[model samples]
Target: MGNQPETHPNPTIDPKSGFNSETRTFQSLRPKTPLPPLSQPLSVTDYTLSLIPSTSLSATAMIDSDTDTHLSYSVFIRQIKSLSSSLKSLFPSLSKGHVALIISPSSLHVPVLYFSLLSLGVVVAPANPLSTHSELTHHVQLTKPVIAFATSSTSTHIPNLKFGTVLIDSPQFISMLNNFNNSEPPRVEVAQSDVAAILFSSGTTGRVKGVELTHRNFIALTGGFYYTNLMLGNLDEKESNKVSLFTPPLFHVFGFFMMVWTIAFGETLVLMKRFDFEGMLKLVEKYRIDSIPVSPPLVVLLAKSELVNKYDVSSLKIVGCGGAPLGKEVGESFAARFPNVIIEQVT
Candidate 1:
């Protein structure tokens, strides 16, 4: 009776997840850009085109570290149009719903090819250049690509394609990019729901499955992220010359989305044809890369590697780690090492 004198009130438990919950769906206080109607004829390329300022002649769109090539926004757009024209001329039957299987390393022409294909309502199916013959065959059969865009090194892996292969590194393809034509390619109306790209999964859990990301999906996804950044005052430094080094494979979602995001936000991208730990450090020093989008493993490397100490990485202001969860200890170690750099871990 004496022990029962001090009884406490029982806490209510949540029905789901077996714990008391404070999580609630809340509306954002910040206003966002009105999304276009579902019926709107919009392509991601066109959306990206709209982001380019008409007077932005001097803004560098991308830099090719392999060739030391630089393309400004105006030049980049012009190249897209020219390449679209060339693609149309070469494969007259290439139409909406046609797939272009791309197997090439990161290069100056990758972005141009992607934008050009999407502009014409073509579905881009980019794959890893290092994929084996059987893996390549599986991808080819899955996508049923009408045309293939590959390099000389990777083109041998492509089976007999319907429209043949275009070697991205070949002089013929380079010629197409340089040639200016008066006749514009006929405009193809692409709906917002239309499939833009068939990005593949890591195949870690199972066989690789092609993920069909649509125009509206990209629009909504990117728009929300960008708007949130705008709300956070991240866009206030719009005039500052921002540069980012991308270490992930462009075929993967993280790298693919980063490429699109970098372009949309007008940041100069420094692409490495291949990732090498020491090479990455050198590139960071050379380009004065202000930020980098890295995976979790790279985060641990950054935390533990003595290689980072040898490079002049003072310009690096942000280290964005994503695609996997980073441990608290690893993050803490990274923070301790690079106090000046902001380490943002995104799920």
Candidate 2:
């Protein structure tokens, strides 16, 4: 007689809930109740401050991958308060209605400046330092920033104004960081609906348009991420500290959100002053970068470049690619080359 195949029992079904093996679709595992959102208006800075851990290893300490410089959370927050207080004293007219233009590459001071300005109810408009004077002039007109913040090199790009540009790297700015007399800045009421940032769009199709993002918008965005990571069981995992590398400009939406996301998740961020493909591989080896936020073009490089084989990128476990469409074949090739790494394509 021919060998008989082993017989298996039918899968169990919960008749009361109308769920069975034959069911093609079902209700969400989560309850149908609406998720609670922040009741009161909250600023993005305030929201991030609430998420900061009472004590953490690297969460508070942001390391600059290039310069090997670090800014601990305590010092970062203190500087924010001091800078806010000093800015208020120097330019009392700089209030909720005013905007400050920041033109510089990613640096330790950027976050300090951003948090301080936002907490004081001042709108932050960060623009690409590489933008032409004509392009910047248009942005300046659109944002109408009361004051400007730039590096020594980029400060020349900013045109003459009522309140001129403050060089972030100068000794003067350094003194602002040490102004601890006003330990805590005067509380400024920043509503959730108030404009938090005026981010410019990538001018690929036409002249860039400024998009206004509000505090409420960021609150909900951060909340959604928190809920997602919680459900995925990542937030509670007892794993080695994760380090992430950002090759994109922080001024762009993708880079901007990732920076804030890293802060929320307590991950150490490794910033590249500018994106260079070869330099990125070296950073991964040096910093032991565990994950990277990449665009489609970068994914293509990973799939085809022999240079990846030269680097010891064994520590990398995640590659998040977005900003454009990626092909199925490219994904398959990347997966075949590095089976240990998970490639998440964000559309």
Candidate 3:
């Protein structure tokens, strides 16, 4: 980590721009509202600044649309503030826009880590748990994250990439939160154009390309889908939809935009790190999944899995396929086998 660029704990005006790249982006217009100018210089670490998170700030958050978990947004923020203090001692120069890869499995941790980093003006790079060593390496290379927060499960898989890393196995997240109130909140600037996330898209060429999604760009895309689905009454289209995503990586925009955004609203998503026919069928039986979002090849495999008949798939109503066009015969066969399942092709 010695070769790493020195972190700027305080907001420093870029010599050329004389403006903070992070601050400019945050001051830019958001989808719903324009970011207000700061009356005084603000530190990214100081989350109390009403401008950064705007009115989204809260004491408790009611997350867990998939499970019945009562989460508090207020308590969660306090934990993040505590973590920030702990991390400061370990990382003296951490900047506001520094990227951190979150690798925890607890659904509760996702929102906590996400907002915590955001509060510090830190960008997040969420990788798939099933990502191979090579895949993780590519992501590290592309984003050049300052640190990665993960469990011991993935600690061994990080290849030759160079960056500061943190382990968050159970007691660790709490331990980090223990050291609270010692350091200042990060004082970096942010903007809508500044990327909140850079998801790697596994293109048709098989090479992973990072998709730079600015805060506004992401909000627009997610908001568009939200509005379109609402107008079209497709809100429930994915609700309780029992489907397998054989092709989509949650890291990809298609997965996050198409699959995740809906769940944030109210859909109960059956998250599978990777698509396996037998495993998916087992899930269908166990959870009584209603519809599955899949790719063309998986749609074909669904017909072959014959395991579909072994489970109680009567709850399923939507079977979606995309990424490439399926042949008419393949589509017909899928329909014949899943007669009760409505076939949806991406328009």
The best candidate by lDDT is: 1
Model 1 alpha-carbon drift over 4 Å, by segment: 1-33, 53-56
Stretches > 4 Å off in candidate 2? 1-39, 57-60
Query: Of 1 and 2, which scores higher on lDDT?
Result: 1
* Native-referenced Cα lDDT, model 2: 0.80
Model 2's number of clashes is 0
Cα lDDT tens digits, model 3, 1-347, are 12223343446445433456666632212123222233333322232222212223332233332353544434555667667666665676666667777654545555455546655556778787767887788788888887888777866676533355677756866677645554654444666556677776655688777776655555455455555545556655323322232235554555555543533333344555445677777667665565676778888888777676777767677777666787899889988887878888863
Best-to-worst TM-score order: 1, 2, 3
Ranked by lDDT, the better of candidates 1 and 3 is: 1
Give the range where candidate 2 is weakest over 10 consecutive residues by summed lDDT: 1-10
TM-score of each: 0.89, 0.87, 0.62
lDDT per residue as tens, model 1, 8-115: 132333333234334443333234555678888999988866764444557788888877788898888888888989888888899999999999988879989999
- Model 3 residue runs over 4 Å out of place are 1-93, 102-120, 127-138, 157-163, 174-190, 203-207, 234-249
Worst 10 residues of 3 by lDDT: 27-36
lDDT of 2 by residue, 1-347 (tens): 11222232435444334345566533333322223344675678878766655544334357787789977767777888899989888887788958899999998888789889999889989999898899899999999998999999888779876678999999999999878777578789888879999999988889989999988777766766765666567676366557888887888878787777777676778888888998899999998889999997898898889999889899899998878877888889989988999999754
On the 0 to 100 scale, the lDDT of residue 298 in model 3 is: 83
